[model samples]
Target: MLDAAEQYSREAFPSAKEFLRRLYDFEIYHRKTAPWNPVCVTGLPGGGKTSIFVAATRLLEDDTVNAGAGHVLPLLGFRHLTIEDERSELGILRRTCWAFNRQWSGTTSSAHEKTRLKEDDGFPMRDLKRARDTTALVGFRSGCCGVMVDEMQYMTQSTTANTLVTKSLLELSYLRFPFFFAANFNLVAKLLARPPQDRDRLLSNPVVVLPDTVATEISETAWKNYIRECKRVAGGVLDFDVDKDAESLVRYTFGLRRKFVIIIKSAYGRAREAGRFAAGMSDIEEAYKSTAYYTHRKDVESLIAMETSGKKEQKEFVCPIEVDSTEAMARHRMAQEEQGRAVAEQMVIDSLSPAGRLAYQQAGGPKPDAGEKSKGSGRVKTPVSSSSLLAGSDQFHRKRK
Candidate 1:
């Protein structure tokens, strides 16, 4: 799979799972140098996530778990799980354990093999708790390496922060080391403003938040990042939110957080520039225009795609996947919207054009959001519009056609 991952760096393949297989192998071999917390990937339902992983090269990972007792086995050298993209938290974990047991248990070699299969007895029990435990091991390994998660919101708390999952990962991350998250725009935002401790951990990651912006106040660096992360699978469809004016995605984000996401994305640019993703300057700036989020919250969306998608590097992954190691990121923008950026004049969004404005509203921007409290600092005012400031700067100026 490692060789395939390297090969993927050259050719475009057919499925996301194949990409995942190779990418997983590459990371497993280099687990010692992996970064961040778990990766998270998100999107609307039926985003074709499962197919991506299934298509990835197999046997890249040899670590196995016991199907007999539903026990998670330690890795031979390192580990990579294609199960991060599974639907639910329990599902991701269970699938991982099952994959392991089927792979090893002496049937072929190790205890983590899934191809080994089991007797019809179902002795492993394979209940939700066991599933969670097995998956938890995947996360536990992330502390020092990378862990992938797809549809991040589904496996977490209702709040944007996904407090429970964050808390659990944080506790274990000290030992697990690295993690990743790949989820949709909104959920990624929520996860970003995680509790102080978790947020701190994620900040250390080489995040790649996507370009599904709700508004525009973003800088040019962010725009380039987005371009680097776009992924196109079998169909002509493009994955990872690559519309021209992303205001539509904004409606799903909180205003304050939306604005901040722009900055956070910039950080991703800086990180990449400084070898955050271990990529060269040309490579980081050479790919997709979107910047997929990583850090404590990277995702398997990219991983699945990396392993399962076409082998050709159609474009730089908008987010990390295996071999790539990226995700969409989650946040809690809406949970704490402010009272609509109280200002004295008509407030304009920072980055939208006339047509872009229309697109924004059309993409779910009708409802106005309440303003949000500034992080940590209390009573911070919303940004003053440039037009408003310009107006005050030269009130005496005359305006004529």
Candidate 2:
């Protein structure tokens, strides 16, 4: 069975879960047709690209009950798994060795020291090639059907590293081991500018772009459910007003699951510190202020505006208990009269067309007769020609002349 963390990550984001399903479907389809086709998944930071890969791979790993036809081999590697110094081809080769060896934790023993490649040992190009050969041997023996490289953006930073990584991936592709690369979408130019051979190898790879945030309804439901789950799991260690707190979280975090989790945890900590059982709106505000509110200021402001507008509408419609029935009925009648009057005014304005409405508003309602004078200024406002208004009037003379 998958661990709790992996299960939660997979279930929390429906998009990621769907992506995993599609990837699996593609894998099965490609294995029958073109077995060498790789897969690439791209997204922004904290968009759950890595989560999809982790969840998918863990599912494949933990599924011992359904020992399907052939072994479903999947391996996830990080930047550090390839080697620390990725400035050259040697570093790339070393990384391949490390990944294929599956001893990434680097627990060395004296007995195995002679056979293993030492970091400090001065090895020539031939020796490095030998290590790579050993990697291939071990990888083939281990039945590496698929290889996933997470944080692949780092590998494309330098021309040399990019070329070497591309070459390595292409070689692996030819060996029938489909590779999955996860990186930022900004690296599209670099990823496309590879050599012709690399392009040919990777061109067939399907790219999956992850959304940065969950859907509004999905997030709201998930967060409320999460609160209920927490209450049950934590055994009242943490408390929350599900509807109120979840709404605040969904709005403030703008549906970003990562930020939502961080802020809620921070708010929970604040509530605990204040000796309160429940994390409320106040704690949420405090948590948001301390976290990514400044970084995502515009989104936060928009969320605030939405909440404020909603509250304003709520207040406007709310009935007051202090008003007697007679006064309430009068107020309701007045409100209905005002609304009908405004609607009629708008209808009349709309019938006049754009030019007429402009003149009416500018002249402060309907125009007066030629002989009529203004109520306050005591002067008849005569209509002026467009050309005369553009040239010079006494009104313009004060400003221009």
Candidate 3:
């Protein structure tokens, strides 16, 4: 039987495994058949969207894994293209063609053989736009398995780039090529903003990998389990109390698995620098406050604000899927307001003298409950409506005046 930590780690990314399974089934169905709808895996920057496709590619490439499936890869092969700085439509095409060619021709061959193969394929790399559709049709006829385009968010950097990327996607869809593309929400939003036909063709099939949220009991449990798993993986170099520090860690990292790992690693490094044997909660806090984590800290704060306020701003933190409806946004805003009131109430309570506190308690003034403690600060808090607080403040100011 698997240990609790090992089991949690294994089950941490069910979406990834499901993505791979879908790829496998797609290949099985389309190996000797026509192409089907392509899959688009989307998530936050560090949510492991790319890692899912990469793992799928590895499985597909492994002969042992493919032995049961007749070992015959489908057409288009397993081509992986990373869109870094490819700004134009032609650049995307060229990159796609290159990915196809590279996969078709094994990388182990001699340089001369590689050049000859490229020549034989007649892929007009220098002038693909001029050659147009004929070049892709001819070169890709021999067949590969699938294509995966990663870092598609780069295409949204400029208007020209965005238009060109959409054009390339439309072109691929028209060709009915089987492929997968991993992108962040910006690219997904851009595609969804396109015309009906364009949006339908490209984003009809989406695989969204979202981070674990701490809003619900089930998700919070999952987050805590994930933290424990990470701690177990750290072995002897880290010795933080998972039960005690998990909540703070979740708050610090905004429940992002990657950020959690980064914080843990940084904590370990800090411990070593301070001549400590193992990193603990103090090191984790120092790491989070360190210059190295400043950008991530800002990102976490931005994400928290966006979620709680239901206001979308283009910030460095771009993950937690869009809050769609007005009702949902209002709900989030209300929750935030309630929390703010709680904090304000706690501040007032903290300012009271001992005699004032006793008198207030005796006089039935509300006290903060244990559950009202802020997650980040651990200070007692109590809820009050924004309007009530504003009215109270106005009354106090009027009396002073």
Candidate 4:
């Protein structure tokens, strides 16, 4: 599955192939150098940034983990390094200790000690703290060479001048270990690209940008190929006729590869429910409606409106699916009403005691007796349920019967 996903990504994303090549190059560089300048990979959210790093790591680690048969690049560890890992200096220390152990467990005495201290409840807490605090990461530098930090945007630090994460980054930078920082946007800038002399000098190294925007012609073709491959592999699990409304498929998705696949998956499920051997354009359209919450409906509607408005343009345009203004208004109203009803229901539930709520039924929820009035309102309260309101017809039917 990983191999297929990696291949699919390489084709679907224009930058993916180049990114993988660079990642491998970084591993090679890290192997030659003990610690090196950190590399930053930035892109839009859900833009295949995480996928690239993960896929690259799999390729590098497979040789080492399996039979040690593949290229031995000493140690390149894969971890979901987040800003949360180093909220405090000690936190960073603990994370670094564990990260090193993950890469080189058997070789280093420091790794064994750290592992033992982590698992040992009986061990002196003070001693453990001292050991982690005083011992430098440089000691274990030879064992583990590279580290991948994902979601660098979430990294937080104390308001103090010398932040723990900053200090940790500095420490890692000095070691010359290549740090791969992957984030949705310029989050690494916060960690590495600071002002003046404070700015991380190591960050001046290299940057890998992942493809995140709307699908280009190449991207659209790649996505279509991906769909065909998926259908072939699934063996009738999904019957998506990519050729039927390929334009519709790409347009509705707004060119985000991740969103495209999600829509396809949802549409395929709808097809399965209808007992159809293959999903038609209708199924795809209906599936789109069901998962419409993910999209910026207003933006999509505007884009469709603009294209169909018969305005002056150099190119002829066609929309994948028609936006029904009337239906959209009705859906919007319905959604609003649903939300309002939910809020009102929650308010009523909040007003009721646990026992009172438990006693309340779908049939005209429990009403206060004449003797008992609302504490503040001094009025007899009647809590009605929608089910009870609809039950009036049933009563009439029973009487007529």
Top candidate, metric lDDT? 3
Residue 18 local lDDT, model 4 = 46
Q: Could you arrange the candidates by TM-score from highest to lowest?
A: 3, 2, 4, 1
lDDT of 1: 0.37
For model 2, the stretches where C-alpha displacement exceeds 4 angstroms are 1-35, 60-85, 103-132, 156-165, 171-175, 193-200, 207-209, 212-238, 241-248, 291-293, 296-401
- Give candidate 1's error at residue 62 in angstroms: 5.4
* CA-RMSD of model 4: 17.1
Pick the TM-score winner: 3
The pairs that clash in candidate 2 are 82-95
TM-score of each: 0.30, 0.49, 0.61, 0.49
Candidate 1 per-residue lDDT over residues 1-401, each given as its tens digit = 23423332234223444434433463443344333344344432223333233233243444543322343434321233443223344434444444333422221223434333233234234465444443434433221122333344554445433665554344333323333444544444555666776555653443333333332335233543544343222132222334543332232221123332443344446556665543222222222223343321222233233333334342333222222222222222321231233221125533556576667656754322225332233765668899878886677565431
Candidate 2, 135-178: lDDT as tens digits: 54444434333456565566665756666666655544543444
In candidate 4, what residue range of length 10 has the lowest lDDT sum?
A: 312-321
Best first by lDDT, ranked: 3, 2, 4, 1
Write one digit per residue (lDDT tens) for candidate 3, span 239-290.
8777676666766787788888898889999899989879987677778887
Please provide, for model 4 over 151-222, each residue's C-alpha lDDT reduced to its tens digit, 9 standing for 90 to 100. Answer: 545554335523444565565554444456664433444544455544545455444442221124454466
